[model samples]
Target: MKTKFKIIIGLLFFSLTTFAQKDQVKILKKIYAKEIITDADLVDYKKNATKYGDVAIEEEDKVYSEFYKSILPILEINALGANVTTMQKANFINMETISDLSSGLNGTLDFEKKTGKKLYTDKINETIRNFKPIFWEYVVVLDGQKKYKEVSQAAYLIYQLDKKDLERLYIAAEYALRAKEYDKSIQYYNELNALKYTGESTTYIAKSKVNDEYNAFSSLAERDIAVKIGTHTDPKIEKTPSRTGSIYKNIVESYIAKNDIPGAKKAIVDARLTNPDDTSLILTEANLYLKTEDFDTYKKLITEVLAKNPNDADLFFNLGVISSKSKDGQAEAEKNYLKAIQIDPKYRNAYINLAVLKLEGETKLLDQMNKLGTSPADSKKYDVLKAKREGLYKSALPYLEKAEELFTGDADIKSTLLNVYNALDMTEKAKALKAKK
Candidate 1:
């Protein structure tokens, strides 16, 4: 009998204990909510409010959620710590009344653009009309006369709730970011930061499980820092080099980094104007056009230059190149190359260019070889003449190789020939020739 009685008592105690336990925040809310609330609990709330100011807030479907979660709790906790006023009370009532009224707002929202359906056509909007005012039970009336929750409701409600809850602030910040209200998000993040919430600064902080570096830059802070640094001039990097091309390149780089393609092109043009002798700049502009796949512009630049200096080796070389790439005029290409070589007697590029042209016309090279002769003595004279035909290489080896071929029998020419042969990867032939010598 004694054992059974003890068990029953124990069960009763356990049940009571289980039922007695409550969420601290909810408990505080109920306690402060009542008049003549315990002074001990009020004192506790004071300490907590001082230690942790406003709590984190998030989006709430109900209108009273922010008021209940943020404004009410913060205001109430602060009021309990100090003085509560009628005006302050009125403000709280007004807020809560507005909240309930807004909460009751139920309507479908639709949007229309002049052009009809668009991406944001189905967006939601809140609307309510009418309000009513009451003492403790806050409410606001809109337009034609209806009452709803007012500020006093929020204030008094906050006064009753615990001020330390923080989970909502993160939600608030996230929603702010979604709404493109970065500045407001930053404010919330900053509030969290002030409380020493490490993860408040980072977008991924919400998923933080353990030890991680605290990110201090909220989206707003990040933007602000960019603005701050952006507004301030860095005289060092900004200093234009004495070389006109260098300055021009730097300007182009800056404009490009800012995603101003036109600005970058303009800088190149300006630089060309500043240093008309800098052929590289002109080439740069043409290359820039080519890079942007603006082949028309590229042609314009080179063509304009060619009009002024038809004999320009670089221009002719590029024109011939574009022509060949386009497969438009091989015959004209050969002619221009020949002219470039004629204009510049020692033009090595002209020779290389003409040699490339011969890749498609291998048989044409025989005609060039015929110009040399069938015999060794004739070969010598022929090779020398071949060397003079840099531009004529519609299919032929250029001057240097031709020169080397002519000197093939002479000791100096033989040595030069051997080196040239080695350079051309005919090492075995070069070795055989050396051995024969």
Candidate 2:
């Protein structure tokens, strides 16, 4: 008889517990169905539902997750507009709209974590998957707009979602550099270096039937599919060169921009060890030495570079530029500039610079001429200096004219040529240049 009474009590407890669980599910369903559900509301519901034990909490979480999943589309439509394109065709969206949608999705993710259920897993995953490429498209548009900070943000989003694509991280770093966010750029670049991302790949391309233009596909499979379809033809594969050298080069440049000379020196040393064959890296080192006023080392490095790349006219011209910085470097500057002109006969800037270098010699003569008195000896000296000045102008005239001939569109060349002509008393040429202006 006592055992029978104990069985009766257990049955009563089971019935009451079942009733409470059902009651919790019912109440939470009403709460989740409200016109506006907040985080606090969800928290309160979860707390109340947990009082009825695991079964009640599971039912509430399942219901609440489903409710969130259903409302997500509405939130997206509202944030993105009713006419928003499909995921594949996502275009420029302002940050406000993106933030709104991101907030909703993040909240859903949070909800899933708190609930410990797999109720809406697939849908949320699909949405996140779509977000990566959409953010890439946004990055492209933002970069064109020179909204570099936004580009960094969008690229970082892509990186977070798909860390395997180091290109996205690289894009983030580059844009961060452009945005002058040095620390962020350094951090991203460090991550890339640690990952040893070489940025080498094969690109599959096909000619589009619609525009007769070549379009690159994301993958070989996609390219093959496009080729199998009638919309594309003449598929080809192109190998993209590794950007390893440039990555290190930019890191050094960022360090230099931050005025951290020692850091720059260390970075350049490390970078050269990684990519010694990259002449651009050598040029960067030469530039760093130039910045630190280590002229001997700068010239030595540049000369070394010129030996390896003898046919590079720009290197010769750059050497000329470096030499031109000192009062004693005229002959060296003139020699380098002449060598540059010889290599590229139509090198317009070299001609202009050589002319400027020649014209620079007149400064001392003019200074002496300006300090002269009206005495006969001073007058004689003045005449000699004046004649020398005319001779200098005469010598510079050919280069100025050649520069103007090579490129008729450069304002600096035109301005310099006009001044030279005026100084040399070449009235007809001066008037003609003025008329053109």
Candidate 3:
């Protein structure tokens, strides 16, 4: 009877031990089989990590051990130093997949499990902050090495990780642009813009100093005094932390790059409806017109902008270029160029272009003179014409000299200056320029 009882106890204990081992094996298999970690798994792990203390540690160790074993061959292959093949690259990406899973597991197991603790909150925030940079670094490396498939896989994983992270979306868009995936890039940028407009936080109104001085009047003196004691604060000035304009610009540029003119125009029009007075968007529209060679519309739009903000020297310079495209536009070009110079004295292109217009005028006059007859009557006419041509050259000489001074190494400017000196009979200066060349 005693022998039979011992045998029965032994059988029961063996069965129970076998059952526990099988359960542990099943847990490990589930972890090892995961190719991509989902949010639900993260949430479940968070619950388990908090609820099951030492049991969670034991299971986590088993999962991590299985992961390490699976990636061991890849780690060794990568250690072979610089002669990695496509198969090896694919293996590395597989390892990254496992690492991402490990990160999700560890993040939940270590930090998110302790939800209410300050230390847990801080550590989780730091982990979240570090996650993006690390993932982006990997993506950039794969891209630089031209491991395109790996990049695609990594980018997809990142997007899956956080659809709301605008920085991640931006990086994805940039990678897509690099990969010549314009449509995908546009899609990501659009998503980013949508998220930005829909989210809300806070707005604070505060007075800030526009200058260090304030205009004040003393009643006793009945005179205005410039008080320079403290900052001059303005209540009317308001500022907001916004990135919508830049996002709009990116979307427009991507559309333009894909040769989708209608799409780009639609984006610009939509952005304009929201930000009607935005000069940057207006400039983008003007640039689109310039790209399409619709100079009339470009000129009209820019003219309207100048009417609002006429002090933009670059706008004046651009107007000069547009005017030069029209027939009989030299005078208008000169006027615009002069205005640019008046606004910005050191404007190099303005000086160069003014000189070029003067030279063009001289060339036209000389062409007419060459067409004159060789008779005595025409000879007198030729003399008058010669004087006029010389006067034009003289008018161009100062502007050319200024341009030459501003850009000493410009061969075209130097050559033009040399021609002007020769026409004006400044023989010594012309000889000097010839020697310099």
For TM-score, the strongest prediction is 2
- Which pairs of residues clash in candidate 2, taking residues 3 or more apart in a chain or in different chains? none
Q: Per-residue CA lDDT of candidate 3, range 1-437, in tens?
A: 99999999999987775565456545434533454444554444433333333233354444433433433333344344456564555444443653554455354445435543342234334534544455566677788898764575567566655545555556666666667777877887787766655222333232325644333442312221112333434312223546566667777887899999999999999988978887877888898888899989998899988988999999999989989989988788889999998999889889888877776667677888899998999899899988988888887888888888777878988988887897889999988777773
Q: What lDDT does each candidate get?
A: 0.48, 0.78, 0.66
Instruction: Work out the TM-score per prediction.
Output: 0.28, 0.74, 0.60
Clashes of 3: 0
Residue 150 of model 3 has an lDDT of 58
Q: How much is the lDDT of residue 126 in candidate 2? A: 69
Candidate 1 per-residue lDDT, tens place, 378-417, comes to: 8876666555442333234344355344444556545544
Taking the tens digit of each residue's C-alpha lDDT, what string does model 2 give over 126-244? 66675556656767778889999998877776666456778889999999999988878878888899999988889999999999999999999999999997889999999988887
Among these predicted structures, which one has the highest lDDT? 2
